[model samples]
Target: MFEELSQYLGWTNCFPEGESFLVIAEGTDCGFILQHFIHTFLKRKLPVCLVSTSQTFSHYSQAGIKIGANLDKAREEKSIHLVDLMSKFLNHYTGQIECDWNAKNIYLSIKEELDSMEISANSILIVDDISVLSSLCLSIDDIGNLLHYLHALSKQRGFNILMSIPSLDCEQVQDTQSIAEHYADTVLCVKSLQTGYSKEVHGQIEVVKGGRSNCGVRQYKLSDKNLHLFARGTSMAVL
Candidate 1:
């Protein structure tokens, strides 16, 4: 969907099948990037299972419409399956008056949902952001294990995995973060500018492909319509 980003990542038309993508947002929300992936897959007529721990299906639907992807239509056609963890969490705390922070339950829920859906090599499973799991009092090891299980499940089901997580400490790489990176075929690290905020540039993104020597870094700015990526040192105001 984004030509500059597609070219930077060496994707001609669509993302590679059955590959894992780890998006680590250092100091900002990377939901836009995740939405981009959803848009891409929907454009290709591929199925998507969105495991959202942070946002609702309605939120994605509205955002997808803004980006030219009709998530509601996709959902109606059974091309998009949503697992709303946020709603489940809310219900658990309010209705049931209980807390279940077990990562295994999360894993089982994902597996069950995927099993009930139509999956292929080109299908994708997207986890909006995993920071909520940490807030739910799940340990780092639990989160890591959940990701590992999801990765394995994706591999077995011949589908791609797109997972987003926040980095608590930018300088200190936690074991959970390392585990996510280790299992990913590609990693997109979104970090705020060390020089501080700018009106033209929102942040920087580094694309790392496993076993690849060449990685690309780009400064990006977000718009209501789309994301604009510029080469490092290039400012959007100059464009």
Candidate 2:
């Protein structure tokens, strides 16, 4: 499956080194895609740090599944760390209003935790719905700066960063995605299609970009506890 995607995107490696950004539309199986890629291709038994503002992690856990590594084993090994920013922020505050200082403090807390980890270059950091982070603490420009800083830090430490942005709120996250697409080594856009009058599910993907101009998008499916890629129609040249 990955072989087909690698060929379509002209990528030499399936899970390439450095930071990669992936954006998904709402209700798409973005989390599943990330989990499958890490479990199937990486071949590393390292922990996956999920930094999320939404209840995505909780939702996945409730579904009797996890993103990466065995949940029980990870818990035993103290590997998987689920940081719920919203909960943490609300817990730290007493008033109904939110403050920028409080938000910065949360960011610092996450940074400190990441700094303390003994993870290597193979470890993955999944920042689900960075749009929430942007809306909470910083302006659009500041969010871009923060993302650049995170990308640089990840590259320096040899860790991979996977971030998600919802397409429905694209205006709120367009700058973040644009910065990621330009700075990160790779960018993947996960999209879904509805076909026929009956709303039949047509296809989904992990469309790769930011290298070769004429590369084509590959079709990927996440079902039956597996992720596989196949040849699909080509997208516009990303030059």
Candidate 3:
């Protein structure tokens, strides 16, 4: 999983069962971080559902192979499910469920799918970059409704809800952003380090609030299979 980084933001301390987390990453590397995160749970054979609006299922499949995850086995065992919301852009639909921006129906669809499959304590629902909510022309009210629905589902099923929402300042973005921050059990803010000097460090994160509030900032590097951590002045060789 996160290895040494787990002492900070990994599930070992960050995302416990039946909790909710909001991971805010301003950098593009959020996707890589998320891939490894998903791979970690799959490695543990936890039931996982990924609602993707950013990438196609094939992209995730390739990432699984890159990370050495038994994705095929996980799929066969019904341990992992990917819900693709972007495939329709290519005039195709292929996912555990084809999701839309409608709040109520989305929740019902997700609940129905999870119900039809095996779910357990270690189960988790990951919504890749909730920024898509606003990007898809959803209003603040719409986003709020969606968040509440997902939060309820998490509580009802005893699984965690993990979402990545970028920090934006527009009125509409601001409207729903606060809901995510306030609604989460933990918040992991991911952003690039403002190093006075350049280095290999990928980003910095902090548990600004929530269940694990006061967690300090830490820098990390991302490989296809791992998240490597380093302190200031520590050489990559130390990793």
Candidate that scores best on lDDT: 1
Off by over 4 Å in 1: 95-99, 170-173, 211-213, 236-239
Please tell me which model should have the higher TM-score, number 1 or number 3: 1
Top candidate by TM-score: 1
Q: Please give the distance, in angstroms, between residue 188's alpha carbon in candidate 2 and its true position after superposition.
A: 1.4
Tens-place lDDT per residue, model 3, 91-160, is 4334445445477766676777778767787788888877776766667787898899888878887887
**TM-score of model 1 relative to the true fold?**
0.90
Query: Tens-digit lDDT track for model 1 on 1-239?
Result: 67666777777755688899999998888888888889888898988999988889999999888778889989999999988888888888787656576889999988888988889899999988766776677777788789889998888878999988888863224666787888999989899989888889999998888655236688998887767887878785665
Whole-model lDDT for model 3 versus the true structure? 0.71
Provide the lDDT at 1 for model 3. 55
> Which runs of model 2 end up more than 4 angstroms from their true locations?
1-15, 37-43, 63-69, 89-106, 194-202, 211-215, 233-239
Better of 2 and 3 by TM-score: 3
Name the lDDT value of residue 54 in candidate 2. 71
